[model samples]
Target chain A: MTTLDATLDHPRGGSAAALLRHATALARRSLIKTARTPEALLDVTLQPVIFLLLFTYLFGGAISGGDRAGYLQFLLPGMLAQSLAMGGIALGQNLNADIEKGVFDRFRSLPVARSAPLVGAVAADIVRYLTVCVVMLGFGMLIGFRVQTGFVPALAAVGLSVAFGLCFCWISVWVGMLVRTPGAVQGLMFLLVFPLSFGSNVFVQTSTLPGWLQWFVHVNPITPLVSTIRGLLIGGPVASHLVVTLAWMAGLLLVFVPLALRGYARRA
Target chain B: MTDLVVRAEGLRKRFGKTQALDGVDLTMRRGTVLAVLGPNGAGKTTAVRVLATLLRPDAGSAFVAGIDVLKEPQRVRRRIGLTGQYASVDEDLTGTQNLVLIGQLLDLRTSDARRRAAELLEWFDLAEAAGRMAKTYSGGMRRRLDLAASLVGHPEVIFLDEPTTGLDPAKREDMWGVVRNQVTQGASVLLTTQYLEEADALADEIVVIDKGRVIAHDSPDGLKRRVGGLTLRVRPAEESRVPDVLRILDAVAAPGTSSSPDTAAGARPGAVSVPVTGDTALDIAVPALRRAGIEVTDLALHLPSLDEVFHSLTEGVPAKELV
Candidate 1:
């Protein structure tokens, strides 16, 4: 018989080192794909610029009772939370599109870890999170939203928001794996993110919300997340909300990471 | 059997009520092309998917390079590469990046991956488009990139699922050359194709499947011989005499099929043909036509093309009946 190539011939799932390598390689692929289609980044880049302007002008006066500067400070941190969540929908939509295009089938046939594609995809989405964070904060600060807590804490605030986003996008990844089409992924993620973004204290203080609506706002993970960002950026008590936000990020990773991996493995 | 690069037994998979694969077994020795020749929806892709470890069967044992495909799929994957029916290359990545990503995923270092990608791009004639996104390439170029990506690992076995299904004739011929080159490099190939001519040109052996079952398995010539060898065709001088020629041809051919002769059904103008067992049909018909005063413009006994072979295979008779 002819000799086979001196290949790895390793067991299923591969070793930890190999898994990390595969995931990183796939992450590189995701980044290159993102860079190739720079226009797809409009959701992360231009959308935040537009939304920050619109909301600051349109609702700033009404919500802050003509204290539009105060409203800008209040709205900026919440905008990070909302923008990052919306940014994740694009990740979900892209995953679904890749699945439909049979790109994942090629990945499946390769000798990589089963979770490599998902892990790589989620890791690459840090680009989106960073983009949304910078775009929102840059535009917000330009329009009179001050980071009262100084640059280090403000950097921490951006870091915290991006971390929360990185955790939250697992939901998008899982839904992307679960759905049949790219459009369906977009629609379903909106249905999930819409409630999470609006039903929380993302746009207003919890007390400002109607009493009945305030219950769900306190429970929504984005609420504590926004509160933590606000506490870091706008000089509020942060220790209690920080713990809850960290707990929520950990909880999301716990639930959706496995679900996303299993869905990726089992689904077409 | 021990030299076989791929072996599968009783590979059965069902998608709802449709049996995508039913008791399909196959084997391919090292350094040869094994064509899974079948019509659309005939379990060809299902069998390829199972063998490539992309889809698991309900009941089966499959091995690639002697590794259990289901239990040690990663080992199997290490030895095998697959290019699916659809363009599997990421449309958003440049051709060079796509191949390099696959090489890196296969554990090549960055420099080595880039080197391998460059070589493959050169080999596939994609060097000029290496920097362009795959979505910008034409269909033929995209298929070439997909095939090149699958080859990044220098796998021992390759699975090409309808690689030429949508390609033009020139492009299909290019694919055939690539398959032959891989075989020359000692890589065994399992090629699923709906084109009989492709199998004949490329495969050492062909397994013809229909309705989720292998109906015939043989070398291409053996398949044609089993379907009664050749067809006898006769063209009369006068178009009006086609019915007489059809009747004469039918009399000379065996009566395996109950297809009544039809003068109006001539696919070619003034020509009549029938599946004959061998060249004796020509010897028998020439003298008979001379005596019957039927002047013929053309009369020849030639091997049945795939259209005719397909006709006899799918004519409601079991393959064994024809054998």
Candidate 2:
């Protein structure tokens, strides 16, 4: 029986190192799950490409005054931002599913840091957001969308969207921890993201909307993210929109990170 | 150093209207198994959760390996492993992947984690299926994998909440063997179950809880003794002689002893049983039957089983007498 004791010496390293190790391990598990069930990737892959195709062809002529190229240029960045927002929902759904399956109980019983599972789930989702951006960009270029800025600026645009998506994910994490079912996570996230995506400058300029609606569009969190991507990828006014977008990211983290952690801790 | 590895006193938790745990107390020495046996909704799971630091007790204190559960939960976590009623493994990952992930979470080095995972998979008899996704494994295999995952850190105290709840008899035996192996390896165990036989087989001390309160706590033999002394059964050679045999049994029975005929349809045609108080009753019974011209087909002494003890304890029998 001492053989069992010899096999499990206390894990080496400091507490912080242990936390990082646990987080990475959990992230690796998420990635493996995605790899095994490739269908789960449809949200970040097929969904974005389909959105790019259907929107670019169906609404381009009507919205852009018959100039499909101009509409494609405008729509690509908005679609990328939209896809990033959609990507954030997966984190909540995954967490909710894990909770439903009692997987988090195993995580809770471990000696790892309390926040590691939540943090690891968010980290793994960043990869999903990056995948969606690449797929959206590649699909958009296949038709007629061109990046007006240089390659570095276009990469920076995708990077910025990924960062924003990560920040937005805390809302989903919080919702996931608070809800009892995976289906509830999906429903709640849709209620939140649907209007934010449509009411903003994703398909058409906010100016086209009624005055009252324009006020909401201008202040919507997605608006700054869409505008920032538009400036970086297709060249537009950026400084003010960038600041608002950063502020929103910071505000979201400040509010939702603690909420998510607390919800996770409170859940037995 | 204190030999008691787990101690919980007056732990109370209420889930809205249902008091899941009401003033539950548990204690286990190092390298011993303390089995908490109870029916459904009897709060066995709740007590284990509080001790494992998965749930905070509404009142009272618990210490695991000398760490206060509520105040030093992290330290307690480091010294304990828990396998809940449900198989809590990522179904998408392979068995080896599951164990390795837990190992890594416990902060083992990458290579060490991999090695440990392989060793555990082999020990759990999952080496052949180690590369397959957990979703593909059968129920018994999934449970084994879950148990293997908990051992990745070699926890000093393990909480197994109904470890063999849904397992077949053979699989249950396998799980019992694994638990015994853990105890022999010097890890204290606190297990919860509804199976009295499971308690009899695995527990060093059994705590029987019902309706969120401990009804009795004793060793397997000690519990059986509470139901009283050896039972004497006498089967007559002729079915018509049952009355004569019962009369002789009653006459020979000591004062205060209860004697009854086996009237159930399935019972042998002429069978009678009597609770014999002292060892001398058996000696008196056999000679009394023969002297009365009663021929006997069978006569023997029987010890009360845990099943009878469990039934009497949970069936609203007074707890003070049994304790």
Candidate 3:
């Protein structure tokens, strides 16, 4: 009989501790992957900045009644909200690509928590969301957009957007798990994200839209998130929009987290 | 009782209309290699997945390293490492980073994980490429890195699914050497492969499966004997001496075995082949042909190759006999 090496018998900690350790290890893997392939970060870094400059320069004058500065103030919050909504799609695409490459099978065979890969992937994506928020804010500052509600609320606004972004990614994770290909995940996410981002008040106010489209714009979850961020960064009502946005975040997590996990269990 | 590192009985799995595995049974003892040999879609990979606890069998029981796979899959996972068909290392991470990641996931401390990663990289001859991203490595290097990742935890059992399926012949041989080293280090391996030579080279026992069922299980030589014993080929120097050669072969050939007199007009025109029972046939035929005044160019004893055995076992035998 062959004897195994003593190093093979290293002690394993408790299950919860192991889960946290494994999730963190996987997160490190994602970060290394991002570092090596910085091109994957372009969506979060360049896309948001491009969208911010394009939307502000192209539509600011008309939307703010010839006052480009005032329009940028109104547009910055909505652009941040739109970027948050789009950030979840990157998580979906990454998950889908990992599945296609069969790395998830390797992860599944490990002595780690079943949810570690999903949770770790979504957690790692927070870095991308932060990058998008920073770039958007930094660019907005260059375009005469100021945070009127002081520094603490400005930080709070970024924190809220990230939290909402994390919650919304469960939907992307579920779609990624259910879909057959990364291309399909991209297409499906685009279909959902574009409608939610555009149909909301991200670009134009709800009252400016026709009556039929105004209903969707007013009720869209992105609308409350954008409204809440605007209230936090610039001068506006914060209480109702913040409450509704938090509720929407809670609702998304409640519905999509289990569904995504279940789908992963079946598919992976 | 001998210690069995892997055991599965009546394992069945289905994918909607396709029966991936039906009543498959396998056993592998400690520190030995068991090759599940089959063609594509023959349930070879399915069996590996079930025993590795990556997939649940529809109806059956499997145990790995004394842990029930279905009852406690996590326990089974702790005991097994699986190198899937596609090398599962993260493409964007460096080779060292990939191994370290797996080590950490296996619960090693940070320093220990780094030490083990370095150790495995050196052991697998990947030390030179340790700092390079896996995507930049060639297929063979990536595969070596993947195997090294699996060994970071020093699993008791390793499942290698077609480890050398797409590699060049030289790389395939390198992979075989690596697998041999793992088995020598006390890891029981369950390898799946469509290549017969791979099984013959590395496996102590080979299980032949087809259409989701275990058709035969035996040692390489044992399976070869089932199809036919050693083949004896005699080629006469002169075409006209073929009749005399045939007569010598007919006289000395083993009973109940077919002897072909080379009358066909293709390659080896003056050759005749006889299936003989054992080495004793060589003793009888060589002298008998000499006595008959027949000049022979070549007389050779050849064991049945795996290709012949596989063909006869898969296509010649009836389905009922496979069970």
Candidate 4:
């Protein structure tokens, strides 16, 4: 019979290395899973192309005073931003499914960083964000949206939107942990992203909205993200939204990372 | 350096209205498989989770692999691998991919992860279906994959929470072999199982827990010895002759021993068993039953099973044990 021992080296140092390894492993697995099954990124890829076709021809004359070029120019940034926001729901759905299937329990029992699963998931969604941006840009150019601010600023716009989308992914992780089923995640995320997408200027100009509604548009984080992308793509002095967008992204990450980590730590 | 690999002192945890763990104390040694046997919600899973560092105890402490789970949870996590009751591998990925993912999480290089994944797939006999999605695999196959994933890191201490609840007998034996393979490697295991024979076959030490407390803990043989030396159970073919059989058994069996009468008048009808005083006395009692005009259908003289011991220990305890 085995007896209890009193001595064994139980190293507790190097938590940063542990966390990094966990995050990278999570990201690699997610990327491979996406590669093996492309359905995860299909919505992010196809939605932007479809929106580019449906909106420019259908609403350009009515919304932009018959100036098709101006409508195409404004629609590209909003569509790209909306696509990233919509894809943020994927993280919540994936997490909810894992929780239901008891995969999270397996990870919970392991000796890794508590926040690794959520952090790894958030890290992987950055790749999804990049895929959506490239798809949106490629399709935007096919229809007639030109980037007047050159390649560097356009890349920066993509980076900012990706950052915002990643910050929102943490919020979804918390929501995912609260819900018991994957379908509930879809329902709640749709309710959240729809208002955040439409209440801002995704399809129409915020100036046309009533004064009370315009206040919400101005404060919405997605509003600044859309405006930042617009300023970067159209070459204008719109520095305030860019600064506010970065600040919001940083602030949300700061709050949600610890909150989501706490949620994960408490799980059975 | 005694071979103790697991030790806990007064482990306690509560979830609002329910006390999941009501101060459990347990111990196990190296190369030993200790079975924590309890009904559902008896803090079996909660105790494992505390030792695994997945859940913190509200009070008291536990030490796994010589590391305090509360003071140094990461160290405990490093030495332990846990396979939960359900299939926890990613179903969207293939069998090989799931093993590789766990290997990578342990910071193994890509080539090393693949090599280990390949080896595990072969060991679990899942190499033939390595490329198939885990979702498409049968329940037994998925459970095997989950077991294989836990071994990727080669942890010294393994916690298996009901490893064969939903498996066929053949598959359950296969899982038993996997566990034996671990023990052969000198790895310590804390297994929670409802299957009494599973505990008999695999456990070096058996801990019977009820209502979040360890009621009795000893070797499987030692626990059986608690009830008595031997039990003489007989089932006669004719229902009417059962009373004659019991009367003969009472006459031949030793005096002052507890005997369940086979009378249909009181309590359960036609269900009676009597415990003999000594293991050798059954030799004399068997022949006496044949002369009483009772056709014996089945008769056995053997040690008590874990189920009988459990029933006796929990007989008078409150039925609302989990709450």
Candidate 5:
């Protein structure tokens, strides 16, 4: 067959094969593009490592009262949550750039599934979120942060972190759609994420704060996520935190995914 | 007939207070290139967008490759390729990667996508630059790559909306060649352009739209015939002898046309223009001036051009009035 014949004559997929193939191909391209530009992972790699070093070494002594090494255990889990949360901004930044550059418009003109780019981008972020978690876990070990929960729960902890990251990605997609410029996305995301990161139970236990602040922190979605990761990493029953975190994930998917789909339908 | 790949009737679209497309109509046969010509803000891009399934029209209907665009945009999208006015390729990927990405999106197997990417790269003469990042490509290269990317899915109908807007003349010619190749291969092409010369040189059929409505549609020569008959121009060798050339022009076009002197002397020394009334009649109000007493440099008569037709049609009237 001629190249055109061979290309076009292929079975257009709605079958089981089609779904698997499209997803795998999209993820592969996303990974290849990311691998080609190692700089794309700088935030994913550096954020977790930086937090692990700064919070554990510098402030652990003052905050946890002389058990700085022991504090490593407490800080690593929170850093994982913060790392993945902050890394989610990459989604907004990249989406803004793609939209501005007309890449999304190009995709819209094609017969490809509209969800491919969105799904691919979020799926590719899976690697980024996982990488940050693994790097933090590795460096935490070097800095005297042991995983009291051992191996299986460590993997579960990373899974929870990545899932939370994916949930945040949906929110970021909405932000990316609303804010079409890359610089604007940077400004808006930083402004929104800074308060969410600091005002929650990320750096300290929420109960230590004032009553009103504690209430807000308790309701913060990241608090349940951080608490869940902490429980997973520290060897205890993480049932309630996991349940609450999963509920948040489900809630975000329920609300923001539809908004994202709407924005995507309009923007694309 | 089955040969008509695209048919639109009373297609209308409005954006807020502005009517972007007003009762636009078009028809294109299979294996032919129809160039849609209009000025900026005249809704050429909007028309293409509607046909490409990217936008929904407020009223009317369109069919592309036998599928109703509004009713089944997915099917229309499957049958047609669209190259928007801007370069719409993935800027972060290499040229080959961009093409392959579309191929994969079209559901090609991995090896098949790569092979198709290579083939398109070779066809567009981008093989050497295929591995380079698209961001580093020049405007012309990016445009060609965009066109190539559009073709990766083997779309039977292609909509090129102002595909050569920003390119230099040489690159524009290259794009014309690409469009020619597509039509020659039996792909129905609806090309939008503001450049009358591009339409004249490339279009098998021309549809001229002003504001949002199509004003004229025909072959280039046929459309040129409607505005005016023709013109005969005479040019004197010296500026001092311009009056002499005007006298000759007056002898020709003056009898029933107009005898305004200011209009007569307004003729440039190198040119005195007069309308061609018929095939062989030289009805000059004044005799050949150079033969009588004036020395002239050059004289000629020719049919009206698409440019003149466009200017006469669109000059003083706003596009909305035409609508």
Candidate 6:
């Protein structure tokens, strides 16, 4: 009857197939929500662009000792990392709002998989993550930040950033499901993400940091992610950072995915 | 389980310090409307949620169409549909989009989903606004859309929690029609409502709840009779003849059935009234009052309104119980 009808007639499949269909349908809802309220997309688009412009111009020369060009290449990857961290905050807040608005009540009553709404919601935000990567890439390039590597590695960086953001999103989803109010979700998620983004190598080199902060900077989860993106986008040692970042992603999934699903189950 | 479409026994739930449901029991046979009537915070909604498989009760069990609510919620979900107090449609999506999405989620083919959506939108008088985002809809429109979404699945049992809360009189009548139509199509409905009139109009059985307990349950007319079957009232043409009418009522109506304690003055100011078991009050009083040469301006026999029935059932308890 309409464009969405194309896959509507798939032959009845088993449990996993049904779950995928439900998730895809719900993901379409989230994407439609994003598209309708263009302002919602601004968090992924304009936000990263503003961060890129502000940090590069405000402290670039001072941080790099008058070599602003070198600072752009170093700072752009960190800006991408910041976008990845900030992207999930909206996911948690929106989920909290949806829960509060009683939007999930119908879904709760339906025969669909319990995990579909949360999983679909996280899945839809993948588009937002990709948007952030592209917006940051184009804006960073326009502002003289260049990828010093081949096109394939640059594409890999985009893919890797989105994957990391998806992992980070489970933490947001868990908080969103657990917290009672949207405002509290926002505040708590910021409390979680703020430290991860700021306490890492996103702004300055970990070696240049004071002794007490250096340890946290090295172990800070965002540090490895930023270092990995940097290695992928520029010519550097990608293997170790890549391994550490992959470990962090695995840990995030192993712990938070189940935790978030449990929170969702307890919503009754 | 032979003909019962829904049943709950000893369902209990507590929220922190508040006991929301204390052993609430309810049942309905196939193809009927069971109205769960209550005031605010009376736990009527809580009972519906537990039966709808959205919440698990603390102790007691529920069976929707003979499937255990606690053990197999998903199986129950497939056989039932729920429309909550608040409208649950996506505000960002069009009214048409919201219905189609729910239809698709329920596994209708795309063409079928859209076809179903268009049918529901037209039925709800929302076709003109089907393309508009639900956020732009009025409260009544949004509620109709929400109800439409629930019917997309055509489940055997439907739980409607305050389904007509915000509707106008005409729309409320339409909702009553919807409930009747669902029952006609072989669906049983568990409807929670604060409106006593709605229960009277639509329910085959009415359960009155208060403070998390079932205070009364019966057919609408049965409840009215149980409260006090009928009232015989008379007002004399001459104020001086009131005493004569009261005497006739006292003599003719059942002993101690006259609710009016003011024996000399009459129970209803200028009018004398007594609760009579059935048509006996009318047959006995009319002849006796006529025989006493009582000239009366007004004389009638009528069942107590549901409002009075509801008040007597819920408001104040037992100095002398009304039911």
Q: What share of the true interface contacts does candidate 5 keep?
A: 0.59
Across B1-323, the per-residue lDDT of candidate 5 in tens digits comes to: 45789899998988888888999999998988899988788889889888988877899999988878878676666678889888987666899888887887777776999999999899999999999988899999999999998888778999998899999999999889999988888798999988777887788899988768998899876765556555666555676776666665665562456212233334443555766565443544325563667665665655555456667776677866754
Q: For candidate 5, lDDT tens digit of each residue in A78-149?
A: 878878878988887787787787777766776655666677778888999989987998888887888887
Say which docking band candidate 4 falls in. medium
Can you write out model 6's per-residue Cα lDDT over B1-323, one digit (the tens) per residue? 35988888999999999899988988898888999988889899999989988888888989998889999888788778889999988999999899989987888878999999999999889999999999999988998899898889878899999999978998889888888888899999999988777887899999998778888989988886667656777877777776677777776555556444234332456777777766666777788778888777888766555466667776667745422
Which lDDT tens digits does candidate 1 get at residues B253-300? 765742133243446666777777766777888988887799988777
Q: What shift in Å separates residue B125 of candidate 2 from its native position after superposition? A: 1.0
Instruction: Categorize the docking of model 1.
Output: medium
The digit string of per-residue lDDT tens for model 2 on B1-323 reads: 65888888998899989988878888888899999988888899889888888899899999898789999787788789999999998999999999988888877778999999999999999999999999999999999999998889889999999999999999999999999999999898999988777887899998988777887888876765665646778888887888887777786564677578865346655689887765688678878887888888888876554456557665665666433
Across residues B1-323, which tens digit of lDDT does each residue of candidate 3 receive? Answer: 99999989999999999889999999999999999988888999999999988888899999899879999887777788899999988888888888888888888788999999999899888899999888899988888888888788788999999999899999999888888888888999999998777887899999998889998999977876676757788998887887777777887676786678744336467699888877788889988888888888888887655566666777766767554
Clashes of each: 0, 0, 0, 6, 5, 0
Model 3 residue runs over 4 Å out of place are A1-13, B229-307, B314-323
Which candidate model has the greater lDDT, 2 or 5?
Answer: 2
Q: Tell me what fraction of the real C-alpha contacts between chains A and B each candidate also makes.
A: 0.86, 0.83, 0.84, 0.62, 0.59, 0.76
C-alpha lDDT of candidate 6 relative to the true structure: 0.86
Tell me chain A's TM-score in each of the predictions: 0.94, 0.94, 0.93, 0.92, 0.91, 0.94
- For all the models shown, what interface RMSD does each have? 2.5, 2.3, 2.3, 3.0, 2.7, 3.6
DockQ of 5: 0.53
Interface RMSD of candidate number 3: 2.3
lDDT of 3 at B173: 94
Q: How does the DockQ of candidate 4 come out?
A: 0.51
Question: For all the predictions, what are the DockQ values?
Answer: 0.66, 0.58, 0.65, 0.51, 0.53, 0.46
